[model samples]
Target: MNESLLGALRRAVGEPHVLTGDDCAPFLTDWRKVVTGRAAAVVRPGTTGQVRDVVRACLEHGTPIVPQGGNTGQVAGATPDQSGRAIVLQLGRMNRIRAIDAENDTLVAEAGCVLQAVQEAARAAGRLFPLSLGAEGTCLIGGNLATNAGGTQVLRYGNARELTLGLEVVTAEGEVWNGLRALRKDNTGYDLRDLYIGSEGTLGVITAATLKLFPLPAAQRTAFAATASIEQAVALLARARSMLGAELTGFELMSAVALELVPKHFPDQRLPLPAAPWFVLLETSDAEGESRASERFDALLSAALEAGEINDAAVAQTMAQSKAFWHLRESITLAVAAEGKCAKHDISIPTSRMAAFVTTTDRLLQERFAGVRSATFGHLGDGNLHYNILQPKGQDARSFAATQQDLSLLVHDRVRDHGGSISAEQGIGGLRTADLQRYEDPVKIALLRRIKQALDPRGLMNPGKVLPWQTMP
Candidate 1:
């Protein structure tokens, strides 16, 4: 960065908040520990206007700028490149809940506010934010909305995009786009808020948001059931939907391998089953308290078992037991990470085709990469499957990592053939940008490029992160 640009940035955010050298180290890497980059400085802006001024100053000096939130992204979307001339526009100090409208059931919060804080604020107001995720405690709302995050509760409340009401953004040229309207019914032209929702910051930076809220459920019933196969799991979900409808909040699949990994890594979690090939964690919530809800849930499982939709199933006897059972399911991600390097895939298929998708992928994978253990699991309710492959024991994990691109192409091609998405919940960041460009509709890709060119013509906002500027041929 030039001395003039540095001086203007200092003027916008103040010298104490401006970080260089060692201070810029943390913003250079993402949570996955995948890639690291160099930034000239990390500027922490305390307000949206300050962010705007910093951006404008950077634009004037012709210096590149990268807008970052909590930096907990899996795809390295927020990490800058090795240019070292780019400034990391950290929004950490922009954290604040501006206002909450209990009557209209909406809340306005800054981009840097933690997702968990938003949830808690809603809870305190006797409402539910409904955008729950594994990284809710650390991930920023801007990042979640940016990626259109899908969580375990997506079966009920929908993705982060649906839960969002409006957005406030700073465009590449430091112009403000105040699209934050909290109204539910707006026939406003173009639906511009959506443009920035999942654009991965290639167009503009999200400064704040107005989010929709829901009535808190009066009761919740959670269960962990063992199923014979993926087919059985799907059938069980169909039956549950017929009975519970929107009240059915979560339905997560857990293979035996995933369950085993938890106990192997986490200290307190226990294993109850004698190791089955598959399992399911089903959850339901309702606005009214009814003990019969739990009874009905058990009955649904019983029906599934008798109909052979599933072979065996179990319902938690208490809240503690329910949490304990869920501990096994939630720990799968961390446990898998502890096992060392592996090629992880997050893909989606049509809900009706999930069973066939799993069977085909599993069979094909087991056939090709000998001893490459595939621990298939995740939000089967929404067709989002975590098709992760583990390296063989007594072999180098790095060897398996080398085949990631080929495996990704094969997997994404299958998904595309089935009219499924290459990426389901996660956005196409650095990890999947090439695959996205290769498989996404040519016309759609063209439009995306046009939008990027119009808004961020300089390619200064998180460059080389989402859209592929050139075809790989």
Candidate 2:
């Protein structure tokens, strides 16, 4: 059966593209290196027609198909299971910018197009594709849409779902659904485009997307500020929103510990302000020139300082300085990985209760797990916190890693108590299926299961992800 399926895949996407043995190793592991699996073969398909043929071949043989793009997901959603009975459907070869309608402010890109390339294409067209992420250079648009990624700019432009108008998906049955309408107001039936999105490939494979674009900002201002506490950071966010309004594009909150890691690991990255308990990095885009942007930023920061919302602040005076400020923020993830084993939680809480939640969670963690350091930060404007807990200094790495489940459970329990979601920007990939079952409402879970059964009855679409294997028929 494995040989038959491999033969079909090879025929569909060429023999050279059907990788086996040592060549398949790269696609079997996840980005975080937390979980590794095995696959029968790794198939790279270059076109939607090839994707459809691969899906059909897998379906005919009753083989599981794990759709993968860029393999940059935090969770193990793109990895296959240990059975070695499935094929990793890699989509990196299908990268292409199909079309760009500047008048409609939309760009159609293949699923494998790198996000940074898409942004550059939009810039070349005198427009802006506002989905900015730390991994934009490597992460593909399909994965971003599959996970509904939320980046720093989400405060103003919203997540990937909002930025996307339509999708070209190859369903579980190998049928192409061309719902790639660029219309802003389409009152269609079921909204199938959204159904496939954020599904993590459980329902279908996102082959391409029609993404919305906006006019390039005349000027963008970047600022970094130090705050005494999370409360002050939240207050500062409120002030920015009130004064800057729509111009405020990004607002990120970082712990002093999180920032300290950047300079500790990278050594070249410098902090702009003195050490404090918390810091905020914000950006504002003005349709008007730099003069207007500078004026608004000055008013906002000055008011924040006067009200004691911030202890100190520094605004970037040049484009190089602005990129430097953002680089520091983006470097936090790599710094955390370099530190040691981490129990990471991507959670979202109401901005109103964010301060209390962080304070209480920190205290509870210290009380229960002695000396577990918190390296926390994330998009404060959109209420998504990358709240990560690092192993204590001088602790046994394996022992500390073992406590990941318990640590995450406690944090997620508190998240539920505070009316927050356990999984925020990162979808419930294979890593959090158990957590999803634990924290999610039963009714919602039942509905999700039903949708899965309805869309992919054979359960061949990325099995053991988002929904547990035991729950599937």
Q: lDDT, candidate 1, residue 7?
A: 89
- Which ten-residue region of model 1 has the weakest summed lDDT? 464-473
Instruction: State each candidate's clash count.
Output: 0, 0
lDDT of each candidate versus the true structure? 0.83, 0.94
- Give the Cα-based TM-score of candidate 2 against the true structure: 0.99
TM-score leader: 2
lDDT of 2 by residue, 1-473 (tens): 37788789989999999999999998999999988999889999999999999999999999999989889889999999999898899999999999999999999999999999999999999999999999999999999999999998999999999999999999999999998999999996888977888999999999999999999999999999999998998899888989989999999999998989999999999999999999999999999898898888999999999999999998999999999999999999999999999999999999999989999999999998899999999999999999999998999999997888889989999999999999889898999999999989899999999999999999999999999999886
Tell me the TM-score of model 1: 0.96
Error of 1 at 240 (Å): 0.4
Q: What is every candidate's alpha-carbon RMSD to the true fold? A: 1.8, 0.8
TM-scores, all candidates, are 0.96, 0.99
Candidate 2 ranges with C-alpha deviation above 4 Å: none
Off by over 4 Å in 1: 469-473
